[model samples]
Target: MPSSLTPPPVQASFGDTDVYLFREGTHAQLYRRLGAQLSPGGEGASFGVWAPNATEVAVIGDWNHWSDLADPMRARADGSGIWQAHCPSARHGQAYKYRIRTRNGDVLEKADPFAFLAEEPPATASRIWTLEYDWQDAHWMGTRGAANALDAPMSTYEVHAGSWRRKDGQFMNYRELAHALADYVAGLGFTHVELMPVTEHPFYGSWGYQTTGYFAPTARYGTPQDFMYFVDHLHQRGIGVLLDWVPSHFPTDAHGLAHFDGTQLYEHADPRQGFHPEWNSAIFNYGRHEVRSFLISSALFWLDHYHLDGLRVDAVASMLYLDYARKHGEWIPNVHGGRENLEAIDFLQELNRACYRDHPDTFTVAEESTAWPKVSRPIEMGGLGFGLKWNMGWMHDTLAYMREETVHRRWHHDRITFSMVYAFHENFVLPLSHDEVVYGKGSLINKMPGDSWQQFANLRLMLAYMWAHPGKKLLFMGGEFAQRREWTHEGELEWWMTDQPEHRGMQLLVGELNKQLRGEAALHQLDFDEAGFEWVDANDRDNSVLAFLRKSRDGQAVLVVCNLTPVPRQNHCLGVPLSGTWREILNSDAKPFGGSGWGNLGEVRTAPLAANGHRHALYLTLPPLSTLYLKRDADV
Candidate 1:
């Protein structure tokens, strides 16, 4: 959170900016939120939202239809709080807001339910114009769909828009955000930016999980047009954008879509079936045709609208379980009650299928943590159908290992090495997500078990291992800089640490890691679908050393040796599959990443034995808690 001393980075960054850092791309907004052009497509469109409470509600502002309606909303005896009215003579290049009469018999300002653009005010809401930009994003997506290089090292930069920067307790706009954020992210060398949910929401907190509008980009940040320009700008810089999407549940807002149309239009009708016990949110009835359509349409809307490269579905475990949030009195037993949200499963499959079918290049990733089979498998072969599933087990297992790891006990081979068993079974991404480091768990940096020096060493090694692992890699924001505090969206990254060299050093390492991800064959295409990665020493836990070889189907391999021990070891014996020379590629013990001045650059060792019908064996000195990648050829 922003410190009292600093008033939080949010105040500094969001300071009256006209844009946000992570805006949607141009041409990416219209397809998601379709609107009928008012007045022969002259420009402005009048929209009416249903908010039944108290009395008067008016569409005020640049529309000028009711800018003077001090108590804009009108009251009805129904007491349902349904406020509706047409914005007369509404047009573009203007602002608006809801002049609503609250239940307390008092008037207050609220943002428009359908407004695409919002200003930080008393700021008038801008009249939104439908995006009709001409371009070739669809064409760009088409090529990546067929055979885009999935083999390139994939290092993703995770971002959160609201907390990324909010000055004066206000949000930034899409236009301002796009240019600044694109330059910042692209300059960092990240191949992709994984943004937290941008879906429209009423509250500023909840990190967007309590979503009210399935398709609307939060007007809290900016306008649809501004967001679109952000996306287009990023694409021009060669950055892939992945949106954080929430289809699992909806917020229980009274005026929102939850009970719109005077029915359970978006969620289940029964309280037992509709609500989440812990979250106090509404669950969808995926079994319903319209519900399924809503979700499927949502997936398409993002892909088709902003031309986002992909989406990462949130809280999939809740969606996967029948009694996810069940309490003693509020739960349902699905035959076995061992988590059988069948409709959710079907809905997932359909969503993935539609995305792939409509745009093969576009990806749909699930945040499911269970042992759900074939999460990344093609839908044809009895799978939930996702381009990728978060390797949640790997995250937990690794974090667990680190918490207990030290210089003395060496390491437990089984505990540290079990993730590979399933990490790559289906296309998966290893993520140190916001879930693992937020709300008191602390940041990934603080998870390490030691003082400043040791902590930095451990973090670098962890990231090295994650990058070299079989699956793709992602790190939540603030983690790159080794922020020693837990995450709170109310503030910007622990920017106070910016003055510390260690913090800035970690940031540099992140930038370099993102660059390294661009062409590392062993990372991108290595065993993406069961064709790469093997453990040469899976059970070598005694020395706290784990070694493995990751390869592509073409027979190219890179050996990774990681030592979790605190003290360096000499000639750590390990198995080798080749008899040729293996040279050192990347070493975490190097000075650039704030290592303990260990590891030799370009050190090469020839294998002494043969295995797997090849003499690919090698031996070399190993550093404590350091990761080194060995390349088999100049090409690797």
Candidate 2:
């Protein structure tokens, strides 16, 4: 019997990709597996759909749903504008979709007029397949820096397989995706592919977040085998794959996981623990043992089955609270009297531990925003055991500096400083993701403060500083090109703009930057070491600049300076380690990264005669919004 405190059952159903939770006391673990059980080996039958507004809708064929004809739908009553039926005779082989009603009913939503991988007979969705995929990621290693190789500096390429490519006016299948995505990411120099959820879904606009099937990849892209092929191809190209694991909540679809198998088999038996108030999605009861095993097994399933490198746990903040959206008595309290959702935390820890245990190198990053302590700390330390937690503070702080009034930022130096205190405690990634430039936020390019020239300079300066910072780094797709407009997931990258001098300049800068990142003696060597960092200067707001240094463990020193002013500042004083000639090895304002021609290249600068008391000193002309990397080899 369900508990009286159990939340009301939501109006949703089950399909593939439905994430369920296993609970124990106040803890829950998440699962990321794939599979659909419809009475093992049941004969083919028509799987019906209910899409209102469609004066008429039909069932399309077929995977392993044990369905018959591709066109079997029974209309519904109560004017729900729905139609549904079953196809028991249809085998799971063909592609399918619905003949939904158009606004004018003249032309219906025709199998994604821009459909990439469509089935014949022009259906709406693919039949659920029960086939298996074989994969091998022998060459693609995992994690880095004591952490799993999968958790290192992850510059992920976020992609929607269907809209990412189109040839012959049709969407490509999984095989096509493997080839296309591989080429794109390899060329761009991204290390991982963070694909939009691949869970089987029905809507094109939802971007796969509203999943319909928990255990199945969307047949829209092709077969499950093709998806695996994509991962394999990514590994062959030296790139890793990170799946978007959404265990926080679920979409409320009628034929989905909700209330499936004659009960709330996949969701929480009680309403209190299994409902998400904000997203209107079904939540999981993290207190069930069965749910915990299911969630943990799912994570292991993906790593074992797809040879995936990692998982980016989405909406983690939503999962760690008992009163996420509640204002009153609907929620319960833990032993501490706090309103924390203890079950979710438990499940999360279990999932992290299991993933680490199964594939010691598999990485897990939490997309958590709240000030949850020790989120990235080890499990034995009484913390959630994610391999890396998004350094959201870095993202928000950096973006705020770029967007808000700069004059106000001086007082907010502590905001940026706060990032470093926790940076070394656990693995962190400085991310500039899709969230930064969506809606009214504008693109990175548009966020530039000064004119076009200053904008590019600022962007480059920030990148240079970011690379020099002590932690893993990530930049969103199109950011490398200094995209001018906000991102539109529906459109392809603004590749056409690559021809522009500024855009091309940004591209070249990224390439060379990455090259330097690997070859430079200052970078890539003991970068994450706690002792390798120091704050040399921060009071340069008049010039709107800041300077810092990254020291090698072997005593090799590298100095970085940034000048954000429009006019070059003469004899700018920057405190340094050595009073000798510090050669300028790299500068952002140089023509290399599409900035104004104001830059000094390879200029071994002479230091000031007088010292700053503590370390050696240097006084050099700093260009506006330019970043310079200087290496001091000798102690003069």
Candidate 3:
């Protein structure tokens, strides 16, 4: 049984200009017109959808008792395949779906692609919700350009909101998590917090990567307004927010974008081009004009509505190659007969252009693994336009080298120094991200090859080296305090580990590293320029030692020395650029950092003896498995 009320008169929402831009694939604000939006007077809601192949479409919702025949929509005469309807009884806070009658007489129910809010997982319906928030981050908005500058000190704390922390083993609301995360991140002195995808997805295991709702945030935490509060609160605390966005592939869920209007409207019809073999998902058809508009709109939607600081695009390598995970006969070459995905490349360039053109203060990062050229360069430079690219080569090489026994590390000494050959290839972010700690990979502390004490020492040394390396820094959530196990979405982090002395020391070391990274101009002011780095000593393979200098634009310098072996070295002479008192700014082997307390007694003076191509040298005692930072005293 259905209500006998007559449907409201058809009110067209899309004008000629919107249609032209939408068809031309340049519409960046489709959310304003395509989704279920309430009228100005709050009387009823207007709906618009694109189903060119459908014979009939209707609005089915709680207001009409989920009736398919109660309200029928009209197709535009312009043959743009757009369907429109107005339901006087439909109001805000109601669940709805489109009942589309296919051309061959089949009925399909699909959720709104531009939905602002969606029902929690296991209930696949879109909720008609408004995005009205009273933001109090004007100060952050007006001045974030400086905080997000290329020369700024940028260290990110990567978090998965569902598993970051919980209350009584239950998920915390966005408002509650906002305060908790802001306090913790601000205390650690990280400039930004990069959240694993928050876009709505049906499977929690995918961690928001297999996204279904492009324009909506998962209701598992809270409403759209609640998520807004999360960003606002972080900004007020002087912390920026970056979201992980996935446009590489999508799940083939029935109610999702797959087979919309009884056709492959959003994806490729051919299996070779549409299918993702590894994930068993459907790849997007970037060549389609309307699909391009949809994806670019989704990317800008976050920056426009949520006031986010940036987007870290996930699995960009998958999108750039046609033969990404395919065999020889299982792929299609571009029109130029090459392996490059030309259409996707164009889409990426256009996406970056739109994001920067609309929101100049925000940035976009690429998680590209291959040796793609100039990923972080500008579009005019004939490269993929991104603000930063993850240094996957550095992460893999360093971790592989650390996993080997200390006795065998000297043979692989090139692993630690090879990154310097192409260190300045692109604006890189040295990321120790969640990918390293998942599956059977083990935790960061356990990755070090040594006894308990030596393992902790090695971990500390690695952190110091990463901070002094030639790029920005990113560490996953549990790595800050050395969570003992691999990461799983089903459980929260091991918060009790912080109570232990060894784990607490790791936490303290991270905070100190971040403090020094922010406080010392020589550490971060010229992270991307080779001019900021110099090899003080790189040929000490027998000692398994390495040293380098990080300099600022003003010639201020900090020398970093690493002793990888377990045996201490006494009277080790290291060359210096200046003859003055070198103050020990940081030592990973200090007693407070859960070490054996072997160091150079806080200071060392240079002598006239030449070593390592320098006119002056300093005699020092290097601790076991330690990395130290020494800066020349300006007042001396």
TM-score against truth, every candidate: 0.82, 0.78, 0.98
Following a full C-alpha superposition, what root-mean-square deviation does model 2 have from the true structure? 9.1
| Clashes (N, CA, C under 3 Å) per candidate | 52, 75, 0
Off by over 4 Å in 2: 1-137, 141-153, 163-165, 168-170, 269-272, 405-416, 521-528, 606-614, 633-636
Using lDDT, give the best candidate's number. 3
Clashes of 1: 52
Error of 3 at 527 (Å): 1.1
| Overall local distance difference test of candidate 1 | 0.67
Ranking by lDDT: 3, 1, 2
Angstrom error at residue 309, model 3: 0.4
Put down candidate 1 lDDT per residue, 300-416, tens digits, no spaces.
777776788899999888988877767665766666555578878888887787788777777778898888788878778988888878888889889988877485444455778
lDDT per residue as tens, model 3, 161-250: 999999999998899999999999999899999999999999999999999999999999999999999999999999999999999999
Pitting candidate 1 against candidate 3, the one with the higher lDDT is 3
Candidate lDDT (C-alpha), each:
0.67, 0.64, 0.92
Best candidate, TM-score:
3
Q: Ranking by TM-score, best first?
A: 3, 1, 2
